[model samples]
Target: MEEYAREPCPWRIVDDCGGAFTMGAIGGGVFQSVKGFRNAPVVSLKDSLLGFRHRLKGSANAVRLRAPQIGGSFAVWGGLFSTIDCGLVRIRGKEDPWNSITSGAMTGAVLAARSGPLAMVGSAMMGGILLALIEGFGILLTRYTTALEPRLALATYSSPDPLAPGHLQVHAR
Candidate 1:
């Protein structure tokens, strides 16, 4: 029997953290830039050019200062979540969305524990729900694609020319 190659836990955690950090950094940069531009003061028409320059500068500064903070937060959250997920998989001896949802909830609760009991509960619920929705969507997408695959293959092999006589043209709506 050929054994399936799998990434070790440490490397998987590292990969998850690095990817999450990069995603967070880029997303934070764009969000902060837009927010800064929107909050920038609009001066009189006479100084519109100055206003524009101010907005540009403000946006750049926001990106420079806030992006790293947001990125670090995301990295921490991701690392903790991934670690929990790996641990759950090891304990349960299986892999599934339950692990992700549980991990997300635990990570959120852990991160928010310093805030208060209410905050921890709220964060845990929010995290679990969010992960559940994401996993549900993924499952739906996979099922839809799998269901379509045979039909798509049939369509492709049925006829070379759509306009030919007796050609069954499949229209996907």
Candidate 2:
């Protein structure tokens, strides 16, 4: 297990839940606002200003009312995902992208189980694919950053003399 993964399961769950909730709430608010604005009734040219104000107010209300619901759903998904991930780590005796992908698939399926088997299967596949993409991106990013480290070191500047600090030279490998 990684040093960071050593945290207690409950704490991980809570942390993931909180983070997911914040993401969902902000995203939901923006989505709801856009939806509300799009759906708001179109008023005549004479009432354009009033119509704009009405649309804004409507969008605000939609965000206020819907954001929390979206946040709660995201929290549930995060908590469940964290729990499954912790369990997988313990069972598999390793930490890797597979664990994350499996956890995401299971979480999605479990959450969608209420709807039907088809939905569950679809959700599981979707979740797994999504997680795979995320993990792949993360891996690529880490590699990209790691590859840059040597170049960064080589690109560092070195001053030739302490007396003349204004002049510096780049030493490239």
Candidate 3:
């Protein structure tokens, strides 16, 4: 909805998918270890990824099925957060750091809705604060620039045409 054009290159999608997978694996490992899962940590992660549908390979075959769900949750979170950010920006007159925090918190609350009221509130607060800090830093670094001289908005060029019929020539600026 933003009027400003997005970059033609789409590294954001790559970042989201790759980052989600990494986080999923880490989350799976930590949770499995903490909960005392019997399978090898790697198996536990793989089993979760498999959704416990097909036969489990290695120690993870019997690992509790939650990996796939968690990964999907992350993917959803990334997508929903992006949508919310765009929506908020479009609804508002302009983009600001506030929108970043607002969208982040809203996304977090929705993701944690199933956990409980407390979780929703906690997640929302954390998400909002985290985004505020990160976005604020980014705004400072990119939006405000120190310059040696003001950038040229317009330049005038007036010169004789290289190819001309006669002494009478075209001039442009």
lDDT-better candidate, 2 vs 3: 2
* Top-down TM-score ranking: 2, 1, 3
- Cα error, residue 14 of model 2, in Å, equals 0.6
Candidate 2 wrongly placed segments (more than 4 Å): 1-6, 158-169
Question: Estimated TM-score per prediction?
Answer: 0.85, 0.86, 0.49
Runs off by more than 4 Å, candidate 3:
1-70, 143-173
Minimal lDDT window, size 10, model 2:
1-10
Report the lDDT tens digits of candidate 2 across residue range 1-173.
12334567778888999999999999999999998887877675588889898888888889999999999999999999999999998899988899999999999999999999999999999999999999999889888988887877765446656577755555755
Model 1 weakest 10-residue run by lDDT: 1-10
What C-alpha lDDT values do all the predictions have? 0.88, 0.88, 0.65
